[model samples]
Target: YMQKVAVINSLEEDMKALPDEALAAKTSEFRGRLQKGESLDDILPEAFAVVREASRRVLNMRHYDVQLIGGMVLHVGAVAEMQTGEGKTLVATLPAYLNALEGKGVHVVTVNDYLAKRDCEWMGKLYQFLGVSVAVIQEGFSQKRKRAAFNADITYLTANSLGFTFLQDTSTVDRKDDLVRLAITRPFNYAIVDEADSLLIDDCRNPLIISDEPDTGATERFLLAHKVKTERVLRLGHYVIDRKLHRISLTRDGMLRGRPPNINDLWEAAVPMGPYIITALRARELHRRDVNYIVREGEVKIVNTSTGRIMPTSRWTDDLHQAIEAQEYPEVEIKGRTKVSSSITFQTLFKYYSKLSGMTGTAITEEEEFHEVYGLSVTAVPTHKPRRRIDHEPRVFLTENHMLRTLRLLLTKARSQLRPVLIGTASVADSEYAAANLRAWGIQHQMLNARPQYIRREAKIIAQAGVPGLITIATNMAGRGTDIILGGNPKGLAQLALENTVLPAMAAEGLHQQLVSSLPLAQKSWPKFAQLFPRLKAVVDAKLGAHDTSEGPDVKDAGGLLVLVLSMQESERVAKQLRGRAGRQGDPGETFTLVDLNDPLVEAAGLTSGMEAARPFLQSARRYSCLPELSSLTQDAVERTSGM
Candidate 1:
């Protein structure tokens, strides 16, 4: 890899000397070489050099040596475990452009629609400048639009969208127009999965299912089961829950107790009462509101556990969705159960590609899974600069209140230094809990989670999350794709200013609401807006200027973004990802974790029992408290269990 980087660097000056037109012409030139039987490896160095130079010209961002190595790792169809903020996005352009020369399509899979669109628009400029056609596949895209996107040289989409599209195309359609036609027409060529661990490992358990035939009379049974579980069954006395396995079962006493009035009717209708009761119990005990899913406009929406984003089109399978709905809104009309027509897991979906590669900060932990499942090796790419982030010892508290109190003190200290703090909570409910405490403490902060309002303004909130003295509480991995620029992102600030100031004024003047409503559309029509309303440009420019001149240096001096993890995640990878948010591009930062002994992770790992077993020993050793050591042990155990 170093030798290849050297060769690529050797061609950098020559590539730089070429004009924009000539640099872009290299795309066609490479295609001609490939047509003449030259392999991608034969042209790798020049191609990388071309991409590096084009990036410098178009995006004004040059790929560092380490990033070039990361690109090479991807081009060879391996996972490049690059640290966060190490220019993984730019590293992708190299292999994507190189592979697209075959005209066989390159798919860049992101975690969600927001990232798919964001990366397409952001990196599409570089690809387009190099004369490579790029498109993004969104959930609401028409079939024709999807066909066009798939036909593009490079396409960006989520793993769910890709898997579902493949499933939809295989539905034995009678007419061509009725089909997505993606799998039938487009070849499964090279794929680059961003956040590889989340997609490949964390999300592999969830298969993409397309269901159609609705089962009648199931809603009543589900509602009855939910009512029985909530009103009759006690958790400890009537049922037992295995949090790690996500299983719940009724106790002998509960089974011996009288059944619900409609239980016989449900059994006669072919719906087993035991399964319904167990499903209802699981829904009530395991699926938490605002944690596992959210109630938006009176509808239950499943939240993606890995990304902490709402999967708007996703639902629980096998009557699980109806059970949750029944548990949440018993009075409302519950949707009927649907039979699975077709389904595909992410593991099977990615395996369909001819060549697969991925980039993530946390793939090393699951490298064995990658190699075993996908036949891909994990390569750790060095960061451009040394990581200066300080990871403090975990502080364990016996109670949640004590943990919150310590968190408050830490936030106060961060505020005193005018340092930005990112509070990473395990779930939306936890984030809200932190938010309520912050509000009571008179602390101003932004909360980003699966809530409807936060979803729309995510970009803006993450943009200012790193501004000096600003506090942002986000669920798990809320802003995974977008970088929280240390000082404040100037472009993001300007966009925020336009949305806050200019767009409202445009609406007041009776301008087309759609034109001003959508940020991208508004940006496209900005020149006209500037001509008609001169103040709009002034407002945006002022914001850009002020952000450019202020706060960033102070933030750096005070130390970069401080990441405060309220609780340890089930997997150490997620905890590391949260810490990765800070100290980007070698910036100085610190990470501190406060663990509640009663946290679900602790309970799930059976650490609570272990701690109890050592309680007497801990009490005797007054001079040396091992609470922190025990907390670390708990985290290790959780990570081990998660890997299993």
Candidate 2:
């Protein structure tokens, strides 16, 4: 890696010698060489150096030596496990530019539409500066727009969008007009999957299905039971829950209890309501509101457990979604129609790409899975700076309420010091619940979860989370390509200023002037702020703030950013990703895990009996025991017993 960085660096001086106009010519030269059948490897150093220079000029950000190495790894088709805040988005430019020279399309896949648009626009400047055409594909994009995006030199989009697009292209008839409408004319030459582990492994079990018709009969099965309150049915002790597999069934005695008392006549009137009742029971017990899903606008949206984000296009198989919808709102109409015309897992879908590489903060924990499943090797790229985030040992509680109380206390203390706090819950409901408790305590906070239409503001919420004294509640915090800077993001502020304003430079200039006049101190604090204001650089740079420019030290003095894990996720990689939000790029931060016996992780682990056996080694009480060693212990037990 050092040698590669050194080689790339060696060409920096030569690239710097070229004038602004010559830089564009250099890109055409690279393309010409590629047309003549020159390998990308032969021009790797020069191409990377060119991108590095372009980034410095266009975005005013220089690529670190480690970032160059990371880019090289991806270009060679390997997963680079760079730590959080190491600038993965910028690193992609090197490879993205190098490969685009081939005139073949390069797709940069992120976890969501927010990242897709944000990265495309944020990094698009550098690519455009280097003479590469860039386009973004979001979830609701029209076919014409999608075709345009797919034809670009470098396209940015979510993995799900890419998969659906690929499926659409494949299923369409191979004709000229059909090809234009279905798009994806180019072959799957290369793909860089951001947050690889979460997309490739954690979500591999659930296949993406394209259905034509729903099963109307399945909806009728749950009708008899749906009329009766789900809470009442759950009150009976007839169901047995296999928490490990997330499956539930009726106990023999409960089965003998026969049809529910209030709903017995309704059950007899229907054609075998037993299975539907069982399904409803499973939805009530296993699928939780806010955790497994959220009731948004009176509809049930399945939450991706791995990412703690809503899978808008995903629906539960076996009529579970309708069952959940019926349970949530008995009066609301339930639409149940299902015929799966096509389906494929990430494991199967990504195989079509000629080259697959990925980058994430927590890929090493699932290194084996990456290699075995995707044929992608993991390379642990050294961070640009040593990580300084302090991760405290787990604080295990006997019950969830106790943990919530402790969390409230922690937030109160952190806010008093003006430190930013980001609480990462395992699901949408958990985040909302935590936010509610904080609100009850009179603490102000913003929440980032997978709610309907929440994707639009997700980037802004995450970007502002690092402001001093700000407390933000989020789900998973995995595969969110946006970086949480220790201090506030100045560029984001500039972008926000341009959001609602007119496109003309004069209008943007007027808004920028208004913004700077209101916050004159921003100029000194953010050296790049003048870039947003254009020709007003000289006037803005003359004035200085009352205090020092950077907010990093002030945040550090107040304890930097604090990450609170309200619940444990199933994957250690995800937990690591959450903790990674802090101490990024050597920034001072702290993380703590406050878990309880009621958490899905603890319940899934089946560790209560194990806790009893290991009581002598734990901090015990009469009612419950503290498994401070919960993570590794529970993971081991779950793997042994459940093979999950």
Candidate 3:
């Protein structure tokens, strides 16, 4: 794949040897070709050639062969499944340029504000070099700045920010006046969604709704979410010794109103009026504070079950978060009103991507889900280097105690070897648990999760993850655009790293001398490629973020990162991400998981193959406990009535 992709990109590089005037003309020629009803596929070679030359001129950055292949996929309305550390930022340029030709605005969707603005500033030079307008949409931008960005040929924005704009567009007091929509009728066009999995899968269940105002009405969803209702909780009994909190139960009155009377009536168990419950939340089901939620601004904030950060955007619907909150403090302030912003689930949002495609190193495992849900297909993009991580089968233990104890042994072995450690956890609580336990073991470490002062803190911690014997506990952080450097490990370990990881940039810079040598004696207008070649060299020279090459104590030298998998995952893709942090680019690293049967998802959904696991958990809960008895019936009624 690398050889083939490289050959193709080389041909594009050849085109840049022409005069500057001729080089600029490629943009017009490509657009003209598109205007003449040429398919993007028909224009692929020339269109890519055009971008290749222009990126050289503008950003002084050249696309690698694989990056170009990923770009080609994007231009053709497909996701490019490139690995992390590959230049996705650059890959986007090929398609962004091609799509912009239609004169319909292109929206480059990022997972967060940091990326949105960063890309616009970093890659915007290339777009501007090609004479295409570019802008980034971040949170809390002034109306004018946002409007200017939207007016550009290409606007970069986060999913939530863009969704907020769509909602704001609808509620604009004047029908003809709005910044988000220049036409006031035009919806957004092509979007290259970064962190596609998080948006398309993880967030799919939560639907998006835009209302003129906040919905103050007490819907069960808001009033009953575990995060929100948890604030008013009064604990009647202490939980199991080690755990801070316990399973939630229903109050007597709640049981009377909520639980179905005939929980065993499988036929009619779904009756809405039953004592059947979601919380079954007795007045005194065991509850804990640090593990579940944290008090912020006198208000209870629900922790993201996966990341252990305060879910500022999430609200308890039907007393779920709130129910959990009520369990925490008897007097946590009530989240009385919720305004439905423009909200859409990942499932629904992806379906709207005029043309849908995405790339992830781990998407193949979720092929069935993608196909079944979105009618999308996954194509394996071969990695430039063979993966060399030492993957051990999940080490399942009977209890959390056993799992932690085994983990200590593993940590001791790695620490002895001076291996750098990166522990991937499932949720915030899990990350915390691992961090707390490691601290107890006299192991100092850093944590990156839902910390409020997000940016500087995260960057500071991640920088040293590549160092030997340095331990860092994180959630899905390393899997996404994160890089771990060698931090100057021992000779033996560094050699293993070189053997495992594929540093294409390092390879490219070596070619730089050849590039200079290859320059024609009678120089043509190869200015763009000349400019880009050096920048490409710089990108390689640039520290891969936290994977710095600094040669000192601040560099935090360590062996390969030892990933402590503290939490269990339901999906293969998730487990892959956790493990993906190690052995990136074929780097030698190790991954191991400590699975405790008591994890909530395992407890709620049960351990089995996807659908089978879900079925048994649901059926057994229905049989043994009294929860979800009425949920089945009510959901049917709602689905039937709403035609959803």
Highest-scoring model, TM-score: 1
- Each model's RMSD to truth, in Å? 3.3, 5.3, 12.2
lDDT against the true structure, each candidate: 0.83, 0.77, 0.60
lDDT of 2: 0.77
Clashes of each: 0, 7, 76
The residue-by-residue lDDT of candidate 3 on 420-528, one tens digit each, is: 7788876555678788899899987778766465434654566566766777888665556565655632332333343234344456567545545764541354466
Sorted on lDDT, best first, the list reads 1, 2, 3
Alpha-carbon runs more than 4 Å astray in model 3: 1-7, 16-25, 53-61, 173-185, 210-294, 300-311, 321-332, 337-343, 454-456, 488-559, 601-644
Better of 2 and 3 by TM-score: 2
Q: If candidate 2 were superposed on the true structure by all CA atoms, what would the RMSD be?
A: 5.3
Give candidate 1 misplaced runs (Cα > 4 Å).
Answer: 173-184, 262-271, 511-542, 545-549, 609-644
- Top model number, lDDT: 1
The segments of candidate 2 whose C-alpha lies over 4 angstroms from its true place after superposition are 174-177, 215-218, 227-237, 258-272, 494-550, 607-643
- What overall lDDT, based on C-alpha atoms, would model 3 receive against the true structure? 0.60
- Alpha-carbon error at 38 in model 2, in Å? 2.1
Per-residue lDDT of model 2, residues 1-644, tens digit only = 67878988898888888888898788999988988888999888888888888788889999999999999899989999988889999999989889888878999999888788879988998887778899999988887899999999999999889888776676675333445577687788899888887788777767888787656665655665664434345455777777666787777665655465545532455566676777777777788787788776666778877777788888898778788877866645577767877778888888888988999888887789888988889999998888888998777676667787788889889978889889988877778788888889899998887875556677677767887889998887433565787666655543444543333564655665665476536534555755675544433232112013756568878777899987766767677888888888888999998888666666666777655565554444544444454557664654454225
